[model samples]
Target chain A: MSNGVDNNRRHFLTVATSVVGGIGVAAMAAPFLASLRPSARARLAGAPVEVDVSKMDEGERITLSWRGRPIHVVRRGEDAIERLGEIRDRLRDPDSDSSDQPEYAKNEYRSLKPEYLVMVAVCTHLGCSPSFHPDPADPAMGSDWPGGYFCACHGSRFDLAGRVYRGVPAPTNMDIPPHRFVDDNTLIVGEDAEVA
Target chain B: MQNKSNQGGGTVGDWINDRLPYRQFVEDQLTGYYAPKNFNFWYFFGSLALLVLVIQIVTGIFLTMSYKPSADGAFASVEYIMRDVEWGWLIRYMHSTGASMFFLVVYLHMFRGLMYGSYKKPRELLWIFGMLIYVVLMAEAFFGYLLPWGQMSYWGAQVIISLFSVLPGIGEPLAIWIRGDYLISDVTLNRFFALHVVALPLVLIGLIFFHLVALRQTGSNNPDGIEIKENKGPDGKPVDGIPFHPYYTVKDIVGVGVFLALFFAIVFFAPTFLDLFLKPANFIPADPLQTPEYVPPVWYFTPFYAILAAIPDQVGGVIAMGLAILVLFAMPWIDRHPVKSIRYRSFLYKALLMSFAFGFIVLGYLGLKPATTLYNELALRFTEFYFMFFIISWVYSEPRSRNYYYGAFAIVVALIAVIDLVRDMAGISWIALLVMIAVTAFFLLLPAHTRLNESKPVPERLTS
Candidate 1:
């Protein structure tokens, strides 16, 4: 019963089929792997976008699209800028130590300038877009609420500089994308001057 | 030889058996396999879980034929499948509902193991394999969740992926590598599709194979929590065991029937019942800029999600949530009680099991709500009790005297009285009174009854 009558033949056939099957599986996986890469159209759209902030009034905010993300640019009023100092102690990383931002924006304001703020609108906690509550009296935030961003998705709070408040679900401050001013009222997002 | 002639059953049967050994495989796994005759309704979940797995795989294959993985087309493709494809809605619902049912049956199956100490010494590998399957099943569910490219899918993936970044040095880079992009974009969706459809499923099937193989090698545990293999008949078979084919096969068919009735009731009639299995927020396309007002995970994941949300710090929350699942892996070591079945253990063990189950359900419910003060507090307390059930049961499973029981009861009653007195000047509520009475009765009478029951001794022969 142990005798297969043709041992050499059986071994050769087994090895051949095994090798062919392995090759076939490998070949089949190629298309699936190729499909997982981002497509050309998506890659093209991921390029930098330009925004016109000239018409945006002072103390007003505008949302611009860049690579399918919302880039928030705010022209802070004198009051909002002044209140940023008072809310510094409440910020988790007031000095931007553990935040995702460019080197030029590492100052206390977390922006290129003290007057204007540019940052991604998405919350760092879970990628929820926070609503802009420029008015300190916003009722949902309760008393002593400073003018800033509020994420209703998970109760993550951020200041006017997009600095996350301490003890929030958000681990760090919202990311400030690589951006620089092209002119007095024009701005470009998703690329700095060197990269552009 | 005589065996050679006996193997030649019929021309066609012999022809296939010579090549494949099909008959022997079936006989070994089913017809010749032995199972306990005393298996109860709790044992049905193992076979039911297998049925649900098959349903998920078949439905998922069909879904992949029409589903798109790209972000732009994924949402529209799902709607297209619902609106345009032939009976696509049913297939989709079956797959979705099958996901929940898979977890449902698995949880019950795990509970059966817990009740009977199925993870004891010889079966430790089997339990570890089972836990690995559970973990892979979770990864499969998570990866599949992101394929729809809906709002909840997007944000759920966002929150879960960011958990990796809580590590110190390479955390941020590792997260970017996983996403294959800066954020959860088309690349992330594509990779998740690969994982959900191919990679994790392969691992799950492999682990399931090992789980079954280990189970068959060790045989099965019974409600009596004793080794039936020790009491073999003259025929070299367990005297308490019967052939799995005609006996358990037929019984499992009945299980299948009852399970299908409930499963089809969900699939055909109330596929969207209660909105816990399939959230409405998932209907909208993934919007990176705008997150949903609330982002609770599905019902199966809410218990762990509650644990994650209950903590204030990211790293602590991640560790706690991880430990909640990983704790089950240490069950064999944690529950050092010699007795296998809950029936033989003291009522304290039963009470702990009951409290753990309740705490799990309450945490899941709280996880569905937005993180608020009251809900968060409750979640935190429940999470503590959840862990305490494991710790206390492990450290204090030894039997105690009536004095210890009486002392514990007095302490509990005094605590309840203090709380009641603080609540209102009115007399104790009827609910509290009933609970107190029930506790007193359980402590005073049930212990004696249980002691007598344990002392009554195990039957010399199988009775069921």
Candidate 2:
């Protein structure tokens, strides 16, 4: 068998066969792997959500689902708006530099308008929604607790303006959703003010 | 090989045996297979693990019959199984309990390997196959957990899936790809169902086949850690070895009986195993918008979970958690000491092994609880202890390299102290400082300690 064997031809054939087989397997796997991604229905479900914000009072917060996440629309009072500036020094990202938000909402208040904070209520730590506690110095939140959202899951805290406090598990400020007010009574989430 | 005629003179069984090598295979893998006679209580867990695997597969098949794989109906389907389906509660609880028990038995089995140095030399491939089984089992459990579609299930999946997003560049896209949606939705649940029921189970069974093959190739490592094959008698069989069929099979049956007694007790009585197997919050249906007050992975995963929670940084936590599991795969290469078992090993090695096990249990306990300041601090210390075990094992692997061991100990202690100081420059923890000092002193003085209390010389023959 070893006499006058075409070793080079056999090697070439083996390599050619292997490469073709590899490509065939990968091509077969493509659609199956792609099938695991978000379907068309799931993508379409991520439409813009509009909420009526006219009835919301000072320090009142309402949670609405946008893209399967809790979008918190908080109508902050004069005291809460002032408190955001007061607690800027305690925040991890006071200016929302590293946090996610629209280009227009990237400010100290982390919103398009100063009085209304439209943010993703999910904790940046592990995606748990933080409960809104707007009152300053709430008894359960402690004496020096500047009114903020507190996550019971891992104890991450975000201030009234959605800026995360230092030394918490959360890495950055709560994300501000791309949102805008169509009228005094109407607010739309998932669409930017500039885009609208 | 030519077919050998049966002694029973061409009966119906002989006809089948002649066609297929069923009788030969049974004889080769079971009756003719030789195992060490000195396999003590620790050996029971391996067979028990196999038994639990069978239980899980059978019960899991039953579960899939009635279980709905959807975001909306999954929770309701589980409740329906518990109430409506005939003996469904028994099957479901058995499976849930079996999942926990599977980890329990596998953990003990791995510990048995550690104690007997089963991962050393020829058995390394066997150990690697076992580790692969463990990794696949974790994936199976993770995917199965999402099937319940409860609050804890949703949020736990949410947190764990989000961990992938902590990576730098492709993190976000990778996480989205995993979930099949923006969040844990119907798509995620359905894919997870396919993986849990089909993909991972097939992989697990294949890995188990390889694991058993590797085990047979190397033969079984016993409590004595001596090679039985080295001492064959006039009959060409190991004098200290027994056939696996009548001997070990009977012994394993006794183990299975006791295991099943305890297993069914939990299944019938405390299926949730005092809420450790199943969380209370899981009874409630999944709410995407509102996460439960506390979200924790099942108890089996708590040790690694604690390691993740101990690290303050997001990316750092994820990396540490990953390393904690991946480090186990390197166990075969880590301890290069001549001694194979704890019995003949130095007191320092035994002590280190015990401390490592203790730290693991402590980490597991801490992981289930809320991450308070004190718990987190303790968890960090234990996590340090966990990794230190491997380093210390390598350092003391050879007694001749005493000077090198000392240098390594100094570097390790200094590194720990520096990391502690850098992490908390504002206030240095006294507990961490003490732990660092104690660990430094212990390792630096290991040479003297080993000299005073020397390792017992290994005997050529197995001890009963």
Candidate 3:
């Protein structure tokens, strides 16, 4: 088989074909790529978002964004509810914890609402979020350690109440912030809703 | 043949300085290429598929320049592309729609391969490499879909990555590392970006090169099962093959043109990728605590989707799903026909081919709807038939060039092969025997020369 004309023919074909195909592809891909940016900008602005938590129930958690940080609003479960006393004794700073937390926010529950625990999910130890091991004996956080949060990060454990397990890399309990109820159910992050 | 001076020549031939060089040896093999004579339009699909992969990567890079891989920014950045950036909407749609188009071309390419027995012996390595590329493409697309962090992207990855938990020991940790956190977080997003933009794409490019080199080396298997290489006509070309230049170039353009028109329709209109059936919750970012009801995998994987949904929910079931994929890798080994096309085969072979084609379409459909206890479960087992039928058909059809004996043996094998297994599964081997007998008897009653009376030749190659 001989193709003395093959290379020249292939060249002409490839250039014309690739150009046409390339242009069509470039044109087709234009909008799909374009649709990816608006959200990036909205996220970069790190807007102080409002949460319309009207539909949330006693056990439901609502998540909202504030400063690109994920804020978890969980209605604390009963096991964590009953272990408050034991958690304080084991935590580095118990009752109202340390100066690092706000006074109004420092309660046995350490939250704006005793039922709703609004805290960032990130682990204080190296920044990995402790998984919600809400089940006991985790084999990860260990037995007799009632289910709470386990930072599969470096084995840091938080009690059902977010109090740090003794000897873990995380020193203080998961921080509960200063916040106020805006209305019956709605809540706002990054601002004191009560005063506003 | 042995030149002592050139004997030491390295790959570059410079190492053989005393006598000869290696470049000539390499160059000589690739020169004087000739395409087949009878080749027409069917050949264009392979090249078209290659074209799609190239488009996907180049457009993908453009998307990365502005795509921020963080949940906080992913959803919004997509929006900015539409409302803020200049002609950004077009680029974004191109990428999204381009994904669908990629699959369309690859499917056609795969089917073409199947018809011509392109996966046969000397070309097994080529087929395996191509299949591996197909697997990687699946992974790359799966991960790429998730970067948007939209509901589909979120739940899609969430569902797919969670499939790992089906495995023991490293299940939980593996899932975590894959997500790069307790759940899909910024870390996972960023790392996935690196892979999507740099790592996977690089590997994908390398594999594609291998795919073509292997394909060309084996030469495209022709429909007639003949190596037309040695039969070049006066034009110094394979009587059956054509140069991939002007003939294929002008031909494939029509396919490319139609594909682009459909792509623009999706971008200019349904940029959200959500329709009445697709839903809008997918537009919302994924929430970890809430698992969406009726979550479905992307459409391409629907065939196996039916199979997975059909099985009883247990760890064993998931293994079956994984096996289903690996099962495809064995396809080249399974097809034992001496002939490439079923055109010359006995009656039994044609029937088996028909069953497989029908089964494939059924499995794909079943993957789309919600799994049902009644029809879906039964359909699930048929998924096994989908593959078993292929092997059974091949094992029976080959080795017998005659009609009556081939048909009779196919039935005998099906009975002997599946009887015990069916009985054990249902405690009713008797019923299984009856069904097998009935099918075999039905085919036997037909005249021996039926297949030959109606078989069509392969369609022409390179249609304008």
- Number of the top candidate by TM-score? 2
Pick by TM-score: 2 or 3, better one: 2
TM-score for predicted model 2 compared with the true structure: 0.96
In order, what lDDT does every prediction score? 0.81, 0.87, 0.63
Q: Rank the candidates by TM-score, best first.
A: 2, 1, 3
lDDT score for candidate 2 against the true structure: 0.87
| TM-score, cand. 1 vs. native | 0.82
Task: Give the Cα error of residue A156 in candidate 1, in Å.
Answer: 2.1
Q: lDDT by residue for model 1 over A84-130, one digit each (tens)?
A: 88987787899889888998888878777787898888887656688
**Residues A6-70, candidate 2, lDDT per residue (tens digit)?**
89989999999999999999999999888878888878898999999989999898988999999
Q: Write model 1 residue lDDT over B1-464, tens digit each, in one string.
A: 55563566558777777779999999999888998889999999989988998999999999999999998899999999999999999999999999999999999999899988899878888999999989999999999999889899998998888888777788777776678776788888988998899989889989999999999999988887878888999999998998999999899999999999999999888886688888899988888877788888888899998988776666767888999999999998888777777766665667767778888999989888887656765676677667666755564445557676566556555644554454312233555455554644454435544663232245555557
The residue-by-residue lDDT of candidate 2 on B36-142, one tens digit each, is: 99989999998998899899899999999999998878999999999999998999999999999999999999999999899998888999999999999999999
Please, what are the lDDT tens digits per residue for candidate 3 over residues B1-464? 96644565444445553446455544433333444544445666777777777778777878888878887898888888868988787787788777776776777677777766778877888988888888888888887877878766675676567667556688756766576555566766776777787878888888888987887787777655556665666976676666655555566788677666766776777754554223465667766544444456666777765665554332444676787778767877778665665544555657766766677777776776654434444454456566566545445434444465466557555644553343213243355446555554444434343453233443433221
Interface C-alpha RMSD, model 2: 1.9
Task: Give the residue spans of candidate 2 off by over 4 A.
Answer: A1-4, B1-9, B400-402, B424-426, B448-453
Please list the residue runs of candidate 1 whose C-alpha ends up more than 4 Å from where it truly belongs after superposition: A1-46, A191-196, B1-11, B397-464
- What's the i-RMS for candidate 1 in angstroms? 8.0
Fraction of the reference Cα-Cα interface contacts (below 8 Å) that each candidate reproduces: 0.37, 0.60, 0.00
